[model samples]
Target: MPELDSSSMTNPGSKRSNNEDCFLSLPAQDLWMVADGMGGHDAGEVASAIVRDTLAKYPDLPLSESIQRAHQAILDAAANGIGAEGMGSTIVALKHHGENFEIAWVGDSRAYQFTPELGLQALTTDHSYVQMLLESGAINSIDAESHPDKNIITQCLGSQEMETVRVDSLTRPWQPEQWLLLCSDGLTDELSHAEISAILQRYRTPDQATRELVKAALNAGGRDNITVQVIAAPSQPKPSMRAALAHWVPIFTHSRRLDAIIYTLALLVLFALLYWTIF
Candidate 1:
């Protein structure tokens, strides 16, 4: 299995006095998650904490099932008066299995994939009123960004109206040197996709990328709790000497670069002579 490198950060932001955001990083289990809570007082904090703690306890569970369990747990807490009546949270969870990974999410806490080839790609869609408007052609991407209802999510965990949460999920083949980012809306609200892509491209390491992302968001006016988790696949290993020779032989033979062709021919001739002498 390819090795994984990961980093995570959470902050209350410039306007918020308390953070209602939470994240979980279990590299041993190849699982990571971020939750953004909603409600008044400390209820939002309780809602998001329940999501993080529950998923942390059951790291091996399927992403959707675990989130469902979290939904019930949150509802149970509210019923028992653990939090306010309308407390809830948005969640995005990712898990890796060998060369493949699965991601599941609810509400607007987003999952994104970044690669050198593709830059930054959103892995999960937002479950929000603004997203609906954009999809229906009632609003454009620019309008959605500044929409007054942009923060109004359509569904989330711990909603009194939803007995069974609707979890959106997808599985994809993992690639070397790729990054998976899970973050709350606070980060997205502050930074545009272009800004985020530039930051990721600038910082190759997961730790530096997460730190710079949070900093940029704060600089852009952090109006809500911000949380981010960045996971990177191991860099592809360099080819062995024999493998290098095998790869170059074909390319060099077809190349117009005289020095490269001569170098490859000399290496081949040396190997052939050595083989005959040994035999």
Candidate 2:
């Protein structure tokens, strides 16, 4: 059996009176999400709150459904902007199923997986202009962080005429002691991978680790709002015999229509077996 736990923390930094970071963790489905808001005006905070609150409405939804709900919520919020101005936010969310985790993201918020042996591996791409510079080889990955346009996101919720958020899923052989880190750009922009690894190494729990890490950013000169959520679960726990007997499926990668098909079929089979066995 694997020991499972997670902890998280957020800070407003020294610059902004209004912190625009929003975070949520649903252990029942092993789901976690974090959003970082932009702040030229109050719109950023408004957009961030809308996304978080909308996602919370589906606390028990399947991963795919929850993500779609969040995406649409952002679209709706964008339509409700103040005057001629626009508002938006960046998001990263994770959902854990039996032996794997599904990830979804938009903008520059990031997701990383850390292991005692493998160090830290980034799972999401920054939807920023610096990313384009790196892709074109105009600058190296090292320079992207300090690039003047590093903060300029190529895509974000509510920015375009027709906005679409990208959802990506990855399945890995789960193991005990593995940790998933989800955070806003604030943490990454101000700190290096080595520095973050050092902080995680020093702290034993998610709470302690996240708190200390945010503190480091503020001390270093917090230029933006910061947020983070951690999701940790044992890699290999023996499946309950009953659960094993009932073959289950996850619909994260499925299209909305197909997801309906798969879940419907699965439910029919489950009820059929129940009627036969019980009677």
Candidate 3:
């Protein structure tokens, strides 16, 4: 199995006193997520946290199901949860399933894939009005960046029941030396694609990239809560001996239990056969 190296951070940013964004980086489970929140009375954080906490239960699950569960969680919380009725959050998650990378999202949070060969490519699209207009050829990238309604998202996890929950997803083969960047609108709102790509090209490790990228975004203008998760797989991932042992410890324990059960069953069968033959 390939090993994942990743780093994550969430900052209140230069503007917000409270950070409503939440992120998860679990290399062992091959799961990464970033959720940007919105609401009044600081309820936004609760909504985003609910999504993150809910998804934590099943890290190995596909993004579609996880997001769906998150949506329901938010709704359930709203029945009695303070400030949860209108609380909403946008999510973008990347799951490493076997050899494929599954990228999923709702609202405007994004996941980006970068490699020397491909440079940088956005793996998930925003579910915002500006994005819709951009896709319809009604606006160009330059115009969409400054569009008046740029922040108006069409889908998100919230209290309201959506007629249909649609989670956008993509599956790409996991390749060596490939890096994935998961973040909320905070980073993209300030840093352009070229700017982000420049930072990624500069850093060799996910941990370094994670810090520098957040710093650069803050310098540019951290207007919203900034959350980032950087994940990279080396050309040939080799975990440290200690790390390898830690990962295998649980498997070894389970194997031992299974072996004992099998041995017991075999002994029982053999004894019964012998008794029948003698009698």
Candidate 4:
């Protein structure tokens, strides 16, 4: 199996801990996640950390299952009343499947697939007002920067009942030197795709790429919390066995529904099969 190398960084910006942003990289499973929180006081940080902590607990799930369970975990955390009401966060998660990968996201945090041929293309669209305006042709991409409602996000985890998040999965036979980039609004707001691509090309290591990306945003006047994670697949084997194993470890002792509806459903299906055989 190919091993992934990753690096991440987060900064609070001018505000205190209220606006929390964080990233996690599971090298063994080649999974990476970035979360950006929004809420008054320190609630945002609390919410973001809670989501990350919940996901970090399970590192070894099959990529698709892992992504779904991560979202469910975040929703469960919100429902359990960990923080003040109205607290929510945006997330972008990427998992490697052999030479392929899958992604899941909510709110404005984003994922980017980078290759020398295709350059850098954003994989996730922000659930923000300005994006809607841009899509509607009421405004252009450049105009979105100064739009009055630029910061308004329409969807986020823990904000309402039965929230819908965007989940997308893409896979390609692993290439010699492919990279995956995930980050929050902080980097995109201050830098363009070309700028980001240029920096990535220059930085040899994922750690340096993350650091320089944050430093560039900070130099441009970091007005918000910044979080970034980059994972690059190396052709040779690497040390990610522990993380891969952790991800596969079941987070729950047993499926609560198994003893309830699941068992009943199994019996019903079995009965139908026996009836078909007899009849």
Model number with the top TM-score = 1
- Order of candidate numbers by TM-score, starting with the best: 1, 3, 2, 4
Compared to the true structure, candidate 2 yields what TM-score? Answer: 0.77
For 202-278, candidate 2 gives per-residue lDDT tens digits of 77788787788899888878877888776675646579975564445455454755665677788899999999999
- Residue 95 C-alpha lDDT in model 4: 73
lDDT of each: 0.92, 0.75, 0.85, 0.75
- Clashes per candidate, residues 3 or more apart or on different chains: 0, 2, 0, 4
Candidate 4 lDDT over residue span 152-229, tens digit each: 987776666644555545555556677788998888877888999999888788889889999998887778888888
Candidate 3 per-residue lDDT over residues 1-279, each given as its tens digit? 656788999998998899889997777888889998888546899899888998898886778998899988887787776555788899999888777788888999998999877777888888989989999999999999899899999889983968346898998898888999999999999899998998898888989988998999899989988898988854574799866645533332357556555666777999999999999
Q: Per-residue CA lDDT of candidate 1, range 214-241, in tens?
A: 9999999998889999999766779998
List TM-score per model, in order.
0.88, 0.77, 0.82, 0.75
How many clashes (backbone atoms < 3 Å, residues ≥3 apart in a chain or on different chains) does model 1 have? 0
Worst 10 residues of 4 by lDDT: 250-259
Off by over 4 Å in 1: 1-3, 248-279
Report residue 157 deviation for candidate 2 (angstroms): 1.5
* Alpha carbon deviation, residue 8, candidate 2 (Å): 1.9
Best by lDDT: 1
Record all residue pairs in model 2 with backbone atoms less than 3 Å apart, i.e. clashing: 175-235, 176-235
- Residue 201: error of model 4 in Å? 1.9
**Model 1 lDDT, full chain set:** 0.92
Q: Stretches of candidate 4 above 4 Å error?
A: 15-19, 62-81, 163-169, 236-279
